[model samples]
Target: MRISRLYTLLLPAIVACGGEGDSTSTTTSDQTLDVDSIAAAVADQNLPSDSLNEYLRENPFDVDALIERADRFIRSKNIPYAEADVKAALELDSLNPRVLLYWGDVNFYKNQTRQSRDAWMKCIEVDPNNVDCRLKLAELYSIVQNYRESLRLVNKVLEIDPSEPVAYFIKGNNIRDLKGDTAQAVRYVQQAIELDPEYWAALDYAAVMLANMHDPTAEVYYKRMLEIDPNHQPTYYKMGMFYLDQEMWNESIAAFTKATQLRPSDAESFYNLGYINLELGVNDVAIDYFNKSIQARQVNHRAYYGRGFVYERMGDLIRARSDYQQALAYNPQHEPSRIALQRLAEKMAQ
Candidate 1:
């Protein structure tokens, strides 16, 4: 029962092309060109596309070259070109595990989850020990809330490699969401961090689990994460909620302020800041933050309710009533806004 509206970040499953022991290693070009750098250069039109075009023209049937270019297209989020390249590669070698893996990646990015799942399943069928394909399927299952299937797949990966940190992290998330076993979840994620202390995803989840348990030592984990990756804005947001849970208003405010500064467009951070200001009896400041939250995301009913609260506190009943109405308009089922409106109506009748 995490009280924070902030979403947890789940690391993406390792696609086979980028996974350990990827078969694509055999398809490398002698040029030793970095795909990302080449893609950036192409985007800037500084690199002539004719080089790749000429290569493909000369080797029209080169499955390896097609797959290699497809990998670059996938990285650059050019899914259409990725799909075309992978489809061509599959035409030349339909049973190629590496080509199937790229096809899966392409379809996954295209939001064709079923097609992506089937492609990965085919990859597993072709190579029974394809841990990357298994992990991708597990991620899809998790996304659809099929935690049982996800856990089973991850367990199979652990059987193959017990020291897999990402497997432990995935297992921890499945257990926490499916079974509500925070303590057990913490142990699993902690094991991941113990295996690879620099694993940021594991550290993030460890901090979250510790925070849920109200363990003050969660701050230590958060500080360690910041030391590792200072640009991680979600850590600051989570820390603010952690402080808010303990009623540490100033600390919460500072943490939330930092998060807002890092990600100015984050409506949740703005809303949380407003809520904290209201708790601290700073009506005007709370109102301003709530307004900013609404501006960031107009559908944020929580912001509207928070603004209403501040207006009510300041004896501005008219604006408070209007804000309550606006809140209900955004979320018809928001009981707080409904109750507030009801109370306001009664007060007017009196």
Candidate 2:
């Protein structure tokens, strides 16, 4: 149950476009773009979020172009733009399945759960065999903890197309969430990989699940995932976490280093590096990492707490107390930092 809950937190139940305040760093280590990739993206008009003004200007009522632009906006996490495009598309053709699909997506990101569900339902009503919307509805049900309905939808998708990999993936995820039966849960995801060898989502779920179980076989899946999408932050972060848990110090550092290189503002990865070094009794390195974590994101209460722990260990009660107070300032509900401050106060009294 403990392992199950950990991975549940790790893997979000709802896979949707990022809302406001969600991480959407599209730059390199120092928050700069790769000039080559930027040039390539500019040249490649096929890129989802590439400027669509010319195309839309030529064919004002082209539902396909509107839907395409809406999808691109969604991908870019521009919910307002996406919603505008979705509205235009619906005005042009209210019954377009793709338009409905992205309408659901836009509403989902906006936290309008009922509207999102209704959009998807309307999509399925228009085209009963829309596997994408079906799978999406399944994910939605799972999000709302309606596991039985989620499974029913998954089973329906399987019946529609036995080879649908996402159906199997959803089944696996729902099983893990609903029942916490890891062994049973993973078999379905493995089946998903067997059906679609390059299914990145399934590979991630399977790899992370195995990692939680401390299974060395998780490395194989992680490697394949990196091969498929090397710069994916979650992959590197999760792999780093797995290595940290296994006490594979060098491996964890390398993975997290890559993550930080790709996303220098990733304070959590920095904090993990600090935690790992602290566990190894490398106080200097640990303090350096904790400092880096705090520098990367000043509101990172955990980083402050971690640095405080290192300070306390090094007999710097004043500094430790200051850090703890800073952590609490950022997040008053941070229990560990609160306890640390209390401990420091007691020590100072003595």
Look at candidate 2 and tell me the lDDT of residue 67: 75
Quote each prediction's TM-score.
0.72, 0.67
Candidate 1 Cα outliers beyond 4 Å, as residue runs: 1-62, 145-148, 197-201, 294-301, 311-350
TM-score of structure candidate 2: 0.67
Instruction: Give candidate 1's error at residue 314 in angstroms.
Output: 4.5
lDDT of 1 at 329: 97
TM-score of 1: 0.72
The best candidate by TM-score is 1
Cα lDDT of model 2 overall? Answer: 0.79
Off by over 4 Å in 2: 1-130, 299-350
- lDDT by residue (1-350, candidate 2, tens digit) is 01000012223545432223232332122433232443344345455444555666666688887777656655555556557767878988999888888877776666655776888889999999887778777888877788888899889889898998878988998898899999789999999999988887789889989998999989999999989987898889999999998999999999998999999998999999999899889999999999999889888899888889999999999999999999999999999998898898899999
C-alpha positional error of residue 313 in candidate 1 after TM-score superposition, expressed in Å: 3.8
